[model samples]
Target: MHLILLLSGLSFQFSHGLQPQFVFFQTPKTWSEAQNICREQCFDLATTHDMREMETLLEVVKDKYDDAVWIGLSKGKTRRWRWSLADDDFYKEGERSYLLWRSITDDNCAVFSNGKLNMYSCETNKYSVCFDATKQGADQYILNTQRMVWTAARDFCRAHYTDLTSLRNDAEYQIVQQVANGSEVYVGLFRDPWEWSDQTDSSFRYWNPDMLVRTDSTQTCVAMLKVNSGKWGDRACTETHPFVCNCIVKKLSFIKLRISPQDSMLDLSNPSVQADILEQMSQKLRSYNKTAGFHLKWRKQSDGRVFTKEP
Candidate 1:
């Protein structure tokens, strides 16, 4: 009996040592940004898939002092309790322990205490941990559309595409608007009238203050004009003139300086060589800006070559 007990202790120690050490850190980031950081900088969101893993985490962090940390669980977009880390179907016919309170009310946020689960406000501060995983590149688009509408155009885009093409910045919006020649297209803009189908209680609705539902039934879709126009108006979805499609293009930039045989170092005085360098630099700048037609001029400097936009 004594020998068996000792062997069991040794096995436990071996297993614990093999487990990966979880690193903890505190960050002031939105829930989405925090999740993105985990994927881009650290790893995938920490997944407490089983009681054993949960228990292991609890034991490891039981004594460590820290505020609650965000986890992968959340009140999903539809207000359903879900594991935001993956899209796999959650099984419901499990033992009570398996159904342990990993998810809470539809508060849109979650946290972890040591390994225990807690639901919290998204704005609350907390430490977070992530597991190891590879980062995937953003998807790129080829041909895209840009359009404007009354309200109908906006609805049409929503019904057709995945979602109104979301623009992250002004530059992107400007590019799309320019391509579409100021035509309005539907975006993700919606008012309080829009109802989420998955919400358990249908009594309440989410609304964006900037956008309000129009009284006119014809104003179903939303449209935009210039990049600065932040307001949205509802219109019919059937009328199609021009539309905007958010396109992502992969770009690469390389800067090379060449040295002539006569010079011990790079030749900065050679006008021809300087021109070539400027052309390459211009091309790179255009790539970053996602511009198609642009001209560049090269100027010779004492140390290197300089590239500038051509007038």
Candidate 2:
């Protein structure tokens, strides 16, 4: 007895998937006006989560847009200091909230030098200390001899070790000082006033050195400079410029497929068989469009079985 799989004329809509799209507007408008227009057409002003998203946004900018363009970042009303080691599990009760700054300044990044905590410009190049949680005893803190800015040092630490050293208490501070070895080192502590227009919690920042030094409070809105390697810079919100907008759309699609069983004893009602079928279909879909991401699953019937036998 040969078992034949039948094709259904009906295509089922399983789930909705979200994908991001970046749109550029050449018309000049203030940041607020641009944001309003973006909301009207798309989702909101563009907000990037990481370098990959930033690169995607850059791809939207071609010969038509060579100057700076407004993004979703803007200066917040208040500033807060936080550690680069953002893992909450590493800290107990009030440890993450602890601060031991000897003096605060216009600078945003922190450094330990000459036996005192001082705020320094984030652009200043200095040696950094990395913390290794897996190491035992005195091997926790490792010092990097190469000089780098605060952000670069944090990146290096995250790539190699756990993260830049976070001083949770006095004992941790002593260990960090020993790692510094009388030389100034960039610590995990830093403060920022910038906030995303979409109200996301992404802490990733890519600011030019010039923008980091500016103390202008009126320069609230941020722009991505195509001429300066897409580095972000703060500008007045009232200044008119071409802006980028982002839309995250949920798309529903119906896919149809046909299956033929070579073996007469094959069971199509089995869960494993349904999973294998979905996997094969997913691979075929990927071959057609490499960039389009989607999830695949078998649609169940009223009895919770994926496939039903036909008379």
Candidate 3:
């Protein structure tokens, strides 16, 4: 049997998993003002992860507000293509911006095929080429034959090697092509303009179908329309409306966890033991939604004890 300790507080218990506490503010405020207020309260504008979250938010504001509401999505100013391998020391001066794109489109992720880089949607699956910095000579670039999405490929590379291959210059690009052997392979280059206010990496988008190409420069910030079944639309940042703030739970309610240990003498209170348990739980939670980020920690009691013997 495995011990599963659950912590509850002001957090919204979603059917998917643990989620941030969302507070709906009826008072209308511009996007900037709402962001400022949320920041002041140690929170930020709400960020939805999927359609389940969209449904939850829709239920929250459907009856109270019959108009649009601010969310954290916005077109950030520093929107540019970047590499998954973020180590600056790995690239020479002026080599960081080197790219070999066959054609540029709205698609962000790139793939190397037939000695040319092609922009592709991140959801597309392809074999991944990973870079192993510790390896010497031609053995550095390792090709993973498994077909996986861009993000999953990145995770696999990070777990086994340095990262997805970063083609710094023509020399590196040629090396990657040789490793690919004419097969299309995922690379590290990608560009995403949409950003959340809290800076969380959330790729899930629920955009209104009609506003896919609605690129009005003035309407950079995003809002969810209650009348449109919570579909998101870009709006001017100066426009005022009710907003949702993602808040952190201030208090914690703990539940006892019971586990049958393989070793009878094992100490459950050991920091390493506690950490291993948390890691196990985190891995299980990640299996539900690999893209969603989760922060799990052990909450100590007033006496600095995480676990107590139940007599």
Candidate 4:
């Protein structure tokens, strides 16, 4: 299903079953500079999550520029599979395994059974293994007997235990799998295409076999060479080039809340009170910030009045 997300004043549509639209700027800059510009103007440097996105990126920049453009891909240090749970301090180096499916379907979720990891649709219903830190020994993997989708499983785990079980090693995986009782269970072992920047765990990669040779010691950042069939290759981070950027947005929900203050003597038309309310709302918004953050805005009335007083 598609959803709309609000980032400050910007909005973008994204859905599991839809191909996202891409916009390009012809401005030339280094990879870092291009990323800054994109985040400021669009979203971030274009993230080609799949072949469809790559094809769209190519078509979007076909006539916009004659040179290569910088996408979000880069060869950064410590390539790994980040867990759905964002607690970095929980899992240490060498504790997590890097496994991914070499398939074209954008199934960003993972399930493990029979000692194998497979990518599955996020919406698929299945049992889940939740990591209970409070439990001792291998009793941590709490298998939910009730079947639910991955998102629902995650929510259940978070509400009841820690989260979807994040295995530290093969021993841990085997234990969690046993908790599944021969049934495939969802684990936090999914691969995302976010390789370098943001480590989005997105496995989506578009590389030209001819241009993928790592020869130069200094070339680390990646740029899509338009002359080379939009193939990505490593380049010095200092190199200047016209880059392509993709606007990444989350599906945010807009909620309207009408506040009715009970004060009789206070002036409802006062601008200071409105400013103070907005300021307080901004602070509250900070608490709701997550991987997909939320923002606060005034829901103006037909007459352009943001606040209305009812007697």
Q: Which candidate achieves the best TM-score against the true structure?
A: 2
lDDT score for candidate 1 against the true structure: 0.31
TM-score for each of the candidates: 0.21, 0.56, 0.45, 0.42
Model 2 is weakest, by summed lDDT over 10 consecutive residues, at: 8-17
Tell me the deviation in Å of residue 274 in model 3.
Answer: 38
- The CA lDDT at 86 in model 2 is 55
Worst 10 residues of 3 by lDDT: 7-16
What digit string (tens of lDDT, one per residue) describes model 2 on residues 1-311? Answer: 55545433223322112446899899989999998887666667887765557778888875566678999889887776767665445777677767787878978889987556789888889999898878975698999888998878887886788678888888888887887999999888888777766554345566774455333467889998766787888778998989988766634355444555788677877778766876787677656543233445455556765544456
List where candidate 2 sits over 4 angstroms from the true fold.
1-20, 62-64, 83-106, 112-117, 121-125, 130-142, 148-178, 250-311
lDDT of the structure predicted as candidate 3: 0.73
Q: Give the per-residue Cα lDDT of candidate 2 at 278.
A: 68
Q: After superposition, how far is residue 74 of candidate 1 from its true place, in Å?
A: 1.8
Q: What is the C-alpha local distance difference test score of each model?
A: 0.31, 0.72, 0.73, 0.61
In terms of lDDT, model 2 sits at 0.72
For every candidate structure, what is the RMSD over all alpha carbons to the true structure, in angstroms?
26.9, 14.3, 15.4, 15.5
1 or 3, which is superior by lDDT? 3
